[model samples]
Target: MSSKHKYLNDWAAYFDETGKVTRFAFRFFREAVKPPYEFRELLKQCYVIGYQSLFLVGLTGFIMGLVFDLQSRPTMIEFGAESFMPGMIGISIVREIGPVITALICAGKIGSSIGAELGSMKVTEQIDAMEVSGTNPFKYLVVTRIMAATLMLPILTIAADGIGLFGSYLIESYKGDVTFKLYINKVINILSFGDMVPSIIKTFFFGFAIGLIGCYKGYNSEKGTAGVGAAANVAVVIASLLVFVLDLIAVLISDIFYEL
Candidate 1:
């Protein structure tokens, strides 16, 4: 193909993929509410995606809180704003850092797992078998997984924030001789309903995007074993990128809401 022709073809391909994903999303919405909810599978997936993520998420949150607090201490002390550190950390963690970090972690962990699993099923023709055997594979598989992710992520974000704050408190206590009660008071006094609600609302979008992208890549996977790996890798990349995009949108919306 000529260079211009090839470039046009690539653009066409991108648009086509976007359309297919949109249709896939619409189908999910349609099927999600119809009937015969896969409660069992959803519970299983919640366990798989949510419960299993706690250790890694908690560990990461702790390490992040420790490192960020420690690094920020010298700066705060230099500015003679050391007393403000607890509330500052609280605001940063709860409002921005916690949800974004937790979502990114979920994007990597949950997205790749879903993609690889469904891709393997596709490659092995198991999904086809389920289809032929009179089961709604999309409902049983895709809807359940998506709903599970959507439900689990907010909880996970909350967990990461609380644990991260605790980690921050530990460092503050050690370095600045701050009491737990005072740190807690500072954080509580600084935070409000507005700060939390938007952070939480965005997480649902994050989870939805992650689950949707994972399923889309896997469900459409081709070329056998290689496709499975590619699906997993692509799912992680896209989900993580989408998290940042969603976070940006969320910030804009929050700013507008505050302005109103």
Candidate 2:
């Protein structure tokens, strides 16, 4: 195939994969709402997906804040807006960067892990065996993962925002000679519900994308052990890319709403 043709083919394949994942996500939600809920499996997934990744998320959040503050200070100072640093940094972090970064980290950690785990189960015929024994593997496996991700991501984002703010405060104190109380007060004053809500809302979709794609890739895996690795790799890539796409949409929507 020509290079242009290969590019078009790749794009088409990408869209095809996206459509399949969306359909599977909708079906998973429909099945998940019915009876025979897998509460135990859901709890386990939450533990693995949420609590287990807290340390990594926290570390990243802290660094994100510190580096953002360090990087942004010179620009703000050059513009004679040094005093506005806290609010500007806070808005940038909470409004977009914080949630998106946290989601990407979760995608790398939880998405890949779920993919590998489910792919392994598929490879071992455990998923198939569950079906033969009259169990709904999709419900127990896919539903729980999607639900856990949908629920836990908002909580994780909240934690990340807080940690990021703290990181910013520390940097501001060290470099700009800003006091903690004043910095925090500026952050609070600048942060309306408009800044917080849209960012938090987008994370739910990010979580859903991560969980659904990861589970779908693993659940429908092929080629045995190699397929398991492939599923995990693909899950992280798709989930991370989707987080950025959704974040852009969320920003546009938030702007529309704010104007109204």
Candidate 3:
């Protein structure tokens, strides 16, 4: 095709894809509120998606805190602002790093997992069989997973923030001789309710985006096994990108609110 034609085709494809995704999201809302809730499956998904993900997310947060403190300490020490470390780390972790990092981790782990699983079921005709068996496959399979993710991610983000703070404290205690009591005091004193609320709100959006993207991609998967892998790969990429997008929007909204 000519360059002009190719460009137009690309834009057309993009718009078409966007429309499909929008419709899929609308369907989720429609089905989500209908009767015959999948409480048992939702609980199972929460346990699998949330409880199972804790160790990995916690470990990542711990490592992040240690490394962040280690890297930032020298700069603070040079500036004769070593005492501000706890407040700085606390604010950064609670306001930004904890939520973003935790969501990114889940995008890699949970996003791909949901995609691969649903894609496999699609290719294997398991989802079709469920429909044939008079089951609401979309409700049982998609809604539960998405709802579980929406519920669990905020809780996970809070957990990550706490663990990250603890890890930062360990580093501070060793290097700066800062005690836990003093660190906690500085953190509490410096941080306001505002610092935390934005992060908490953003995590819910992140979780929703992750689950929705994963399920959308997986549900529409075609071409059998190869498509399943593609769905999984695309879900991770899109979910990670959406996390950044959502985080940016959260920051912008917070700034607007702060100014008002």
Candidate 4:
């Protein structure tokens, strides 16, 4: 194919995929509100996607805080601003890095897992079987997973932020002599409702995007077993991209709120 033709074709395919995902998302909304609520399934997903993933997210957050503080310490010391470390680190983590990093990790772990699981079911005809058996597979599978992710990610982010700040505190205590009480007080003074609420709120969107992309890719898998791997890979790539896009949009919206 010619370069121009190939570019046009790719653009068209992208739009087509976008339209399908949009419709899929709408269908999720429709199915979610009506029905025998899948509370048990949702709780199961929360345990699988949220609680199970906590150790990874918390470990990442701790390392992030430690490294971030270690890297920033020299600069702060040079300017005789070491006392500002806790507050600065807290704000940076809580307002931006914490949620984004946690989401990206979840995107890699949870997104790929969902995609692979559902893709395998698709390839094996289990989803079709469910449909034939009059089970609302979309509701039982997709909606519950999406809702669990959406609700659980903010909680994970909160946990990550706390752990990350504690990591920073450990570093601060080792480097200089700052008590936990003082460090926390400094962080509390610097952090405002504006910094936290928007950050936490945006995480729901991140989780939703991750879950939606995973479900969409898996639910539409083709080419048998090979398609399962492809679905997982594509779900991670797209979900990671969506996290950044959503974060940018969230920042813009938060800026507007901050201005007022």
Candidate 5:
């Protein structure tokens, strides 16, 4: 194909996919509200997507906090501002890094897992079997997962932020002589409700995006085992990208609301 023709084709395909995903998301909303309320399934998903993923998320958060502090130490010390480390690191992590990092980690773990699981079911006709048996697969499968992710991510982000701050405290204690109480006081002094609320709010969107992309990819998967692998890979990629995109939009919205 010619370059121009290929570009046009790709663009058209992109729009087509976007339309389909948008419609799929709408269907989720519609089915979500009119349900028999899959509370058990939702709780299971929360355990799987949130509680199960805590170790990895916490580990990543701790490392991120420690490394961020260490990396910024030289710069702060150069400017004779080493004492500002707690406030600076705390605010950054609480307001942005904590949520974004946690979301990205969940995208990789939870998103890929959902995609692979559902994709396998799709390939094996399990979803179809559910339909034939008069089960609302979309409700039992998609809605519960999406709702669990949406609710659990903010909780995970909160946990991550606390752990990350603790990691920073550990480093500070080792490097200097700061006590946990003093470090926490400094962090609290710098942070406010404004800093936290928006960060937490954005995480819900992150979770929803991750779950939505995973379910969409898996539910529409084709080509048997190969499609399952492809769905898992694509779900992670798209969910991670959506996290950044949603973060940007959240920042813009926060700025506007705060300014008002």
Candidate 6:
């Protein structure tokens, strides 16, 4: 094929992939809302996707806050805004860094794991077996995973925001010589509901994107083991990219509302 033809073909394929994933997410939501709630399966998925991910999320959250505070301190000090460090970092953490970083980490850990597990199931024909046995495999397997992810991610982000702030507190106290009481007051004063609400809301969209892409990639895997690996890799990549895109839109909306 000519170079132009190749480029067109690639673009077509990319659009097709995007559409397929969108349809898959729609199907998952449609099925999830129907009766016969997969309570047990949903709980199991929550354990697998959410509970299992706590340690990694917590560790990353703590480090994110610490590093952000340490790095920001010098910059703020140069501007003689040392007193506002806690407030600035608090707003930054709750509004942008905390949610985006947490979502990316979740995309890497939860997204990749879900993709690999579901892809392996597809490769081993286990998903087919469930379907053959007259089970709604999509509802039971895909729905549960997606729902678990949707619910778990917001909770995880909340925890991460908290942990990250605590980490910032520790670093600021030790490195910046700020008192705990003043730090707490500064943080509380600058961080209004405006900042907190948008951050939390963005996480929901991030979670949905991560789960939907991961499930779509795995459910549609093709080349056996090679496909399984590809699904996991692509799922993380797509989910992480979507996190930033969604974050951008969210910030735009937030800016409009706040008249900023």
Compare the candidates by lDDT and give the number of the best one.
Answer: 4
TM-score per prediction, in order, is 0.98, 0.94, 0.99, 0.99, 0.98, 0.96
lDDT of 5 at 22: 99
lDDT of each: 0.95, 0.92, 0.96, 0.96, 0.95, 0.89
Model 3 residue runs over 4 Å out of place are none
Off by over 4 Å in 1: none
lDDT (tens digit, per residue) of candidate 1 on 1-260: 89999999999998998899899999999999999889999999999999999998998889878988999999999999999998899999999999999999999999999999999999999999999999999999999998999999999999999999999999999999999999999999999999999999999999999999999999889999999999999999999999999999999999998999
167-199, model 2: which lDDT tens digit per residue? Answer: 999999998888999999999999999898888
C-alpha RMSD of each candidate structure in angstroms:
0.9, 1.9, 0.6, 0.7, 0.9, 1.3
List candidate 5 stretches off by more than 4 Å: none
The window of 10 residues in a row where model 6 has the poorest summed lDDT is 172-181
As a TM-score, model 6 comes out at 0.96
**Whole-structure CA lDDT of model 6:** 0.89
Question: What lDDT score is found at residue 142 in candidate 2?
Answer: 94
Tens digit per residue, CA lDDT, model 6, 1-260: 99999999999999997788878978987998998888999999899878888888888999999998888888888999888888888888888888898899999998998899899999999999999998898999899988888888888888888898889999888877778888889889998988888889888899888888889889889899999999999999999999999999999999999995
**Model 1: ten consecutive residues of lowest lDDT:** 59-68
Model 5: colliding residue pairs: none
Residue 200, model 6: lDDT of: 90
lDDT of 4 by residue, 54-152 (tens): 999999999999999999999999999999999999999999999999999999999999999999999999999999999999999999999999999
lDDT of 5 by residue, 1-260 (tens): 99999999999999999999999999999999995989999999999998999999999989988998888888998999989999999999999999999999999999999999999999999999999999999999999999999999999999999999888888899996899999999999999999999999999999999999999999999999999999999999999999999999999999998999
Task: Give the runs in model 4 whose Cα sits over 4 Å from its true position.
Answer: none
Kindly report which residue pairs in candidate 1 clash with one another: none
Error of 5 at 153 (Å): 0.7
Candidate 3 local lDDT, residue 38: 94
